[model samples]
Target: SIRLPTPISKPDRSYRVDVYDRPQLAAFMDAVKDKYDNVDQYHKLAYLRLLAFTGIRNGEARALTWSDMHLDRDEPFIDVNKTMSDNTGHGVVINPPKTKAGSRKVMIDAETANILKRWRAIQGQALMRRGLPSNVVWTNQRLSGRISSNQPREWLLAAIRGTDVPQINVHGLRHTY
Candidate 1:
């Protein structure tokens, strides 16, 4: 008979914990801006800015949509409600966050807000050029209604190649947050 190792009592214990310093994250964002000049560049730099400022998880950042953003409302916050989890190597599925607080709203600073506005304009044009549906704020190359988080991860990785920025996983930005 095969013997199994004793199970950990707390299944939810976090296995890895990495803390990011502000200067390191700032340098990464600077590198991103210096390397590219397009919507992908804006998306990544702004995403890093949001992660550094908000301290949210990578999955939360990947799952973000325009519907979650309220720039002029009384709250003027981002609602982090849903997340996407990898379903093997094929794709991902949208899931509710772990807690109500995990689904809470995060306030945006002015600098980050301005970056987002520019990104939105560029994204809008890209979507229009792709012939995507008007109501869809995000889409994949196919002009699908919504883009899966995996696609962005892959794109960011490709974009970061040959750049000075460290080869950190796309989730590293979220970890910085």
Candidate 2:
């Protein structure tokens, strides 16, 4: 016969947090801008700027649609009510914030809003060309209408490569805000 073990409580955790300072951030943004202008990857520039300005989580940003943003209004703000999560890595699902605190409005700077507007124009033209209408803010002209969570990490790597910027995950953009 074997003895059975009792349930145990979860242990505390320590995470290594890395964030970028001013110069590093500028370099990364410049790199992303170059990609956006040279290769026309508009989403790369828009994504990093939004995360850095808003301090919102990855899921929150991914779940956002044009309806959630009031960019043209006098006071631009994002209504962060839902988030996208895919723990299984097979698919993504939209979910409401588990806590009341998770759902709130985040104000964005004018330049950030302008960046979004420019991205919208570019995306809008492509969507019109394809005769498909999608409100997803991070699609990058994809028919899928939404971007995978890993996409941002790929952008980060590309932006930091051969640059003075330190290696950091997409979450670091939020921390830098």
> What is the lDDT of every predicted structure here?
0.65, 0.83
Q: Model 2 — TM-score against the truth?
A: 0.85
TM-score of each: 0.70, 0.85
lDDT for predicted candidate 2 compared with the true structure: 0.83
lDDT of 2 by residue, 141-169 (tens): 45556888888888878876776666777
Clashing pairs in 2: none
Per-residue lDDT, model 2, residue 84, is 93
RMSD of each: 5.6, 4.7
The weakest ten consecutive residues by lDDT in model 2 span: 11-20
